[model samples]
Target: MIRLRYATMPSNGGSRTSTGTIQTPPTPMADTSTEPEVQLRMFSQPRFLAAVRALVGTMAQRLGFTEMQCGQISLAVDEALCNVITHGYERRPDGQLWINFWALEGEPTGLKIVIEDLATQVDPDDIQPRDLDDIRPGGLGVHIIREVMDEVNWERRSPKGMRLTMIKRLQPGRNSELKNE
Candidate 1:
């Protein structure tokens, strides 16, 4: 099971411009306590994918994840974002997507990433990867994310949104491949 403590969004709430850029970073988000969580709100535009991936990759690296594991985590995050943009938002550009990155603590140290989208709400049970036998040009994102992450959970957010939680734990026997300078 994956357990993580996340921070509450600022009381004032936050807003994003039409271009999907935040006018100001929210307060109470950079809690550097034990949990150390970061929340990012952006549009489902393809142009923001690189920045999001870089954020996830850097966080994974700092959390003592191996180089390959970091890549896997980043890939999983990318796929999740793409899935939200494509399937959830139906290729819409203005849809808002929020991602929360949590640094876990305890016996199995790891990272937890939550991708929440306020696009189209669907039953979590209905979301799954297509049959591999069909051999399609796409539709492997769910498969890849499930394979890479240690724990994955999906839920329909209250009102109108979907939440995807992914967690990856560092193996006890393996040491971190990257170190802080």
Candidate 2:
């Protein structure tokens, strides 16, 4: 199990457009996969962002994700996790974020990532397309996620919290090679 926590620095307050004191404590998430594939876990925190990128890069390489594809996945994961850290937890620093990654064996679209966070609900309809012409530092996370992942979906759980699912399908030629073996 991968566990990590993040503490917000006073100077960096509001830099990420989050309110309240965020304390993302490390929580252990279960990894029940017998198959060798992608898997990772990190609580809502700023420092863990880099770790997420590294984990994704390693997983992508193992899954035969091309450099470009790997980069896209990394960026997408970052955005998703960031959302959890910022809006999900509202930078309250009192919650945890759980993430899971796996490669769909014997299929062309051989990879999938599920990010589960005990944060506030985010309406899928509220997500709007970003305008490239407008230069801004914020509001690009959702857009980047959608662009990078082949499939993006969200669901709300009872009581509270939300789950974001992202999927990517490899090209047909790559899928064939993976299937033959």
Separate clash counts for every candidate: 0, 2
Instruction: List pairs with backbone clashes in candidate 1.
Output: none
TM-score of each: 0.78, 0.73
Please tell me which predicted candidate would have the highest TM-score against the true structure.
1
lDDT of 2 by residue, 15-105 (tens): 2222234333223222244322333455567777887888787667666778898888999999888888888887775567766666666
**Highest-scoring model, lDDT:** 1
RMSD of each: 8.1, 11.8
What is candidate 1's lDDT per residue for 60-131, written digit by digit as tens?
888788789888999999999998899889998888777777777776888888787777888878878888
Q: List candidate 2 segments past 4 Å from native.
A: 1-39, 175-181
What's the lDDT for all of these models?
Answer: 0.75, 0.68
lDDT of 1 at 164: 86
